[model samples]
Target: MKKQEQDHQKKNPIYQEYQLNLNLYNKGKTQLGIEFLI
Candidate 1:
């Protein structure tokens, strides 16, 4: 049941967008660190 829910979320486009937004926000916070992380 837990695995099924996790899989569903992974397939969700909204989830991917949210992840991207978080990453972008992180980059905005630390432009220099983001260069190394990416």
Candidate 2:
């Protein structure tokens, strides 16, 4: 079940966006990273 969920996220756009967000979050500021959710 967990693996299936992980695989689903791998192909999901929202998840991809979240990954971009996490990258930005890890890079520096919080404001721009939060904006990715919207």
Candidate 3:
């Protein structure tokens, strides 16, 4: 079922790492944008 797949993703270390990287990338982008605006 779809719920089982979601659970599997939650347990996956690679996926977790990818998500953390994605968050950092987004934060970096936001900071760059603010610097450009100011």
Candidate 4:
């Protein structure tokens, strides 16, 4: 995930778009984790 995100950042240096995608990715990860925990 870290490696993929790094590659994505390099592909898209636009801070706003990168941040948005990162936020969404993080939220998805959180949801998955919660489901796994449950």
lDDT of each: 0.90, 0.85, 0.96, 0.87
| Model 1 Cα shift for residue 14 (angstroms) | 0.4
Which of the predicted structures, 2 or 3, would earn the higher lDDT when compared with the native?
3
Per-residue lDDT for 1-38 in model 2, tens only?
A: 69999899889999899999889878766666778767
- Worst 10-residue lDDT window for candidate 3 reads 1-10
Best by TM-score: 3
Whole-model lDDT for model 1 versus the true structure? 0.90
Judge candidate 2 at residue 26 and give its lDDT: 82
lDDT of 4 by residue, 1-38 (tens): 59998787678759668788899999999999999999
Query: For residue 34, what is the lDDT in candidate 2?
Result: 75
* Candidate 4 regions with alpha-carbon error over 4 angstroms: 1-13
Once fitted onto the true fold, the runs of candidate 2 whose alpha carbons sit more than 4 angstroms away are: 30-38
Per-residue alpha-carbon lDDT of candidate 3 for residues 1-38, written as tens digits (9 for 90 to 100): 69998899899999989999999999999999999999
Q: Please tell me which predicted candidate would have the highest lDDT against the true structure.
A: 3
Task: Point out where model 3 deviates above 4 Å.
Answer: none
Q: Which stretch of 10 consecutive residues in model 4 shows the poorest summed lDDT?
A: 7-16
Candidate 3, 31: how far from true, in Å? 0.7
Model 4: lDDT to the true structure = 0.87
Error of 1 at 21 (Å): 0.7
C-alpha TM-scores of all predictions: 0.56, 0.48, 0.80, 0.61
After the best TM-score superposition of candidate 2, give how far the Cα of residue 15 lies from its true spot, in angstroms: 1.0
